[model samples]
Target: MQTANNCNFRSSALGPAPLPYHPHHPGLPLALPAPVAAAPALPVPVPVAPVAPLAALPTPPPPPPPPATIVQTLTRHVPVPVLVPKPFPVPVEKLVHVDRPVPVEVPVPRPYPVAYPVEKFIKVDRPYPVHVAVPVPRPYPVPVAIRAHYEPLHHHHHRHHYLHHHHDW
Candidate 1:
């Protein structure tokens, strides 16, 4: 008799009882002797074609006479209005030009031979020139819409939520 961790292996009838089934143990099917490599599959013999059956089809029938057709007439009527002739009512008034004279106002010229102040552009020299800044552009996403100010008239009533424990008293 041999002993292993509370299990007994006796040198008698039942040979070791095959250990308790572990996948890593040497008692699996792969540990048995392999089949003879299957004899190289024998090449699978070539198949023969199928033969025709012994039955045949039936024959066709004779000609049918020309079918008789009855005539039918469907009519729909609609009324159209006819127009009448009349004279046109246009009033014609003949107009002609009337001739008369009225007095007119014209400005007298300032007889000097020089350009007016409004027509002259002059550049004056100074130490400090007034700076008008050109704003530097920044890369930002352009807004597509400008929303109007709006407020809802009636507000919904909502209760304040509280977590319940019952022992929080």
Candidate 2:
């Protein structure tokens, strides 16, 4: 029987066991082999050459100058003027006086009347009678009973007999 951890199927002499079908990729192989380690890389070879001493060369002579040729020459002149501003005079102000009217004392009357109406009141007498019936509670009866002849108490005797019988057991 196959367990959860070891779910890989084994092949028999009859034929190879059918691979489990996947819902997505139906063409995938069932059993894959363990991965192999990569091969070791070989070292690359580098070439070394011998160094030689350098020799200094002689400097070349300066080049000869070409023949000279002359072109036309031009000259121009312009004039600019300098200006100076003159000073302005300061203005002077004069004051004038005018007379206004004087106020007089006058009395004014009130807008509404000063007097109001007097309030009147009436008095009532004779009272009405009201009667309420209050409930009075009655006293409860007291229990009283007289026995002609009292029977002998048996509960204490029964308890004593039970205790003695249990001690003998």
Candidate 3:
């Protein structure tokens, strides 16, 4: 049967047999592997010598004094105001209306049988020039010789020479 001391092994079949708790019986001593012999002791190292302290550095010279500044006072004048003369005022009046009789208009007598000039339009036959259709002469096709040379003009001198030679053609 399994017990607390025998819990080290997961399988009870391979574990050690469990011992009963006894107040008088002393517990069985744990069976451990034999103690291993320690390796040989290493040699002691020598102590290092202490270093000397460094010397203090010399103090630096003081900086130059700053330049002096100038102070000045400024003054300004104020302008005076001038007075102008005022113009004279004009008087205004209201108009009054008076009742008056209007004159009667007289009709003038007209002369009998008034003569008026009448306008007359006459149709006249005039001969005009007539347009006639005429056939235009077609230009005859002429065969011309054309020669083209494909060349790369890399230099400015060569391009100018080629243009001058082809200008006449």
Give lDDT tens digits, candidate 3, residues 1-169: 4458744234556666455444344464455457897998998998989765554555577887664231121121111111112220111111111121111111111210111111111111111111111111133112211121112122122221111122110
Q: Candidate 2 regions off by >4 Å?
A: 1-17, 33-35, 40-169
Error of 2 at 48 (Å): 43
lDDT of 2: 0.25
lDDT of each: 0.25, 0.25, 0.25
| Model 3 poorest ten-residue lDDT run | 121-130
Off by over 4 Å in 3: 1-28, 31-34, 50-169
Q: What TM-score quantifies how close candidate 1 is to the native fold?
A: 0.13
**Candidate 1 or 3, higher lDDT?**
1
Compare the candidates by TM-score and give the number of the best one.
Answer: 1
Q: Encode model 1's per-residue lDDT on 61-166: one tens digit a residue.
A: 5678664342121122111111211221111111111121111111111221122232221111211111111111233112211111222233333222111111
TM-score per candidate, in order?
Answer: 0.13, 0.12, 0.11
Model 1, position 103, has a per-residue lDDT of 12
Instruction: Tell me how far the alpha carbon of residue 78 in candidate 1 is from the true structure, in angstroms, after superposition.
Output: 28
